[model samples]
Target: MNSNFDDFVKQNVELLDQHIDELFDSDSTLNTDLKMMMKYSIDAGGKRVRPLVLLAILKAFGKTPNYDILTVAAALEAVHTYSLIHDDLPAMDNDDLRRGRPTSHKKFGEAEAILAGDALLTVAFQWISSTNLKDRIKSELVLSLASDAGASGMIAGQLLDIQGNQRHYSLAELKHLHHLKTGKMLLFPAEAALIMKPSKLQVAELVKDFMANFGLAFQIHDDIIDVTESTAILGKTAGKDVDLNKNTYVNLLGLSGAKEELNQVLQKCEQDLTSLGELQPEMDLMILEGFLTYLK
Candidate 1:
């Protein structure tokens, strides 16, 4: 399943590589400079995890996938990439490298990087709005994306994170921070899939549970990786959290305890999947394993 996911991402990368320029060209209203900046960040490579998650959820529902699916997937990815670009700016995580290349700010100057992130974020919504999907699905997708990516979600989480950097947080506070910063966006893919098929309420609830737990687990694993992984392996600088004195799961709970929490979250996600009873147990297991493997 991991191999299949990787292969799928590779294929999607090729498709994105082909269509990215065309996507910009199709919209003449987009300012040329902003379009170029947006494209610059969008073209910068990453794992394409958010889009892959959307595609996986669609596949899990037995939907007949099409180019429209890829378009929406790409939009979600654009939003995520925009966040990364902004997050790496001097005002945020202050990173110099991303995906093993100079960050947007480092490569394009701070002003361009800021504008690029803004353009990518706005273009994400533009792509969604212009998609030929049903009005209801498009509305739901836009709403879900906005809710997760907006101030009350990722932005809120980010604020707490910056604040938490200078202070220690209890487990509850840490969870709140992560739920906003990371978990909400993770939940968006599953929720967006539900929007694509509104009748699947049971499946949607199951997916929501699965995504919530999985998202938390993913964040916990990220904290672990930040402590253990090197820049070469992580494709970005490690130990930044430590340098910033950020409060992380590892810092609060200790490495062993943090790993145990991750396992528990994974276990909960598996339990939710089992309760769903519609999905293949093997597939669920594969996803769980893939999540762990990718984090490691």
Candidate 2:
């Protein structure tokens, strides 16, 4: 990533932390234990990647970060964090660590962690609703987020992922599982930004295409990382997928093949981003393009 893109990411991460603190951490009305659990996971370190994606899309379309935009981004982070909390539950991946600390369940107990996840997920829409954006825009964002994070999207992908433990998946099946599981959330940022700022039909199509490929690349990178990185580096158990016999790109296509596929997907992402930049010549797409390099 270029210095400008790195700077943009740093600025947004700081802004997101402040916004999330205002929205959740500083709130005093909630029950003490539940609030503590939620805040613990929220404060748990993460790069705020989903929120950054939303902010990057906003910037790509020439929209400056505002109260409404930051709130929306924070809401997106809330949902992402909620997913992680739930994913670490005993019934799910049963992870004991996240973001270099104890997982929510381990730190707060299973029941509290579940409620915390639920609270964060529900409150995310509340955050969106409270935004100063127009009612229609708010509605669109809520609807998009709900669909993307709910049973039809991420949850469905998760179900398939668990089921993968029992069965072998072809490469196409694996891609489909992740497209719903991981792709939808990644795609949501671009979709939400376009909703906020209506672009030309051509530009909208290109943005969606760019995010679609970007999402795939991200998932492949994650699968590769799980095998190659350590628990300390990943902040989660390494090779857990292989241990659980979960289907992944590495298992199906081998490490080299998965890397090749990631490169191909990233190349497609670059092409889509290139077309989008040309279509909207006034916008600097460097930040959006910078995301691809991270996967590589």
Candidate 3:
């Protein structure tokens, strides 16, 4: 699954790269500074996970891939990158590195970094709105993206994390935080795809369960990576979460306990996928394999 996922990711990266360049070229009056900053942040390179998830979901549904799909996928990635930019600000995570490069705030000034993040966030909507998709699909995509990234979702989780400094939380409280901070964003790709498909309630519910469990497992794996991997391997400052006094699965649950939780969540996700009769076996395998790869 890891090898196949990596290959899929590589292909999607190439597609997104072409589309992004085209997007820039098509807009001549785009503010040069903002464009540069946005491009830098987007191109700075991560796993491109959100867009890949979007594409995978669309493929799983056997939908005909179109320009609208790519546009929405890219927009999702834009929103994600914007969040990282703001999250690394001195006022937030106060990080100096991301993806092995200087963080936005480190390379550009704090003010520019803030503006860059703002631009990316707003432009994400612009990208979706300008798409040739149906108005209904466009509206749904916008609403999902806004809700997931807004105060009630990722931002709220971030606030909780900031306030959790030097404070320990119960497992339930920690799971709530993870759901808000990490899980919501992760769930959006799958949810957004379902929105595009307009599936039955049962199928929608299955996708929701699968994504929710996958998101939790992913965050747990991230916690493990923070403690087990080096900066060189992680492509960012290692052990920063511990330095920030942030609560993590690793701190709340022992390593063994966290791994146990991850396994349990993965099993639940797999079970949910199995319940969706129309879902392809390859897609199920892909999602399951992808989750397993994250554990590495």
Best candidate, TM-score: 2
> Which residue pairs collide, candidate 3?
none
Clashing pairs in 1: none
Whole-model lDDT, model 1: 0.80
lDDT of 3 at 241: 75
**What lDDT score belongs to each candidate, Candidate 1 first?**
0.80, 0.89, 0.83
Candidate 2 is scored at a TM of: 0.97
Assess candidate 3 and give its TM-score to the true structure.
0.94
1-296: candidate 1 lDDT, tens digit per residue: 46965665677667765666678888888888777777777777777667777766766666635767777877888888888999999988899988888898998899989888888888788888888999988988899899999998998998998888677999999999999999988899888878886645666688888888878988999899988999987878998777777899998898999999988888887688677654544333344335445654
- Stretches of candidate 1 exceeding 4 Å from the true structure: 1-3, 16-21, 278-292
For model 2 the local lDDT of residue 267 reads 89
Backbone clashes in candidate 1 total 0
RMSD of candidates 1 onward, in order? 2.4, 1.1, 1.9
Task: List model 3 lDDT by residue over 1-296, tens digit each.
Answer: 46777776778788987787777668898999899999999988777777877787777777635678888888988888998999899888888989999999899899999999999999899999999988988898999999998998988888888878858888999999989999889899888989888777877788788788878988999998898899989988999877766799988887888889888888887788677744544444464346456654
Q: Judged by lDDT against the true structure, how good is candidate 2?
A: 0.89
Top-down TM-score ranking? 2, 3, 1
Runs in model 3 lying further than 4 Å from the true structure: 1-3, 277-288
TM-scores, each model vs. reference: 0.91, 0.97, 0.94
Residue 80 of model 3: what lDDT? Answer: 88
Q: Residue-wise lDDT of candidate 2 within 209-256, one digit each (tens)?
A: 988888899999999999999999999989998887789998899999
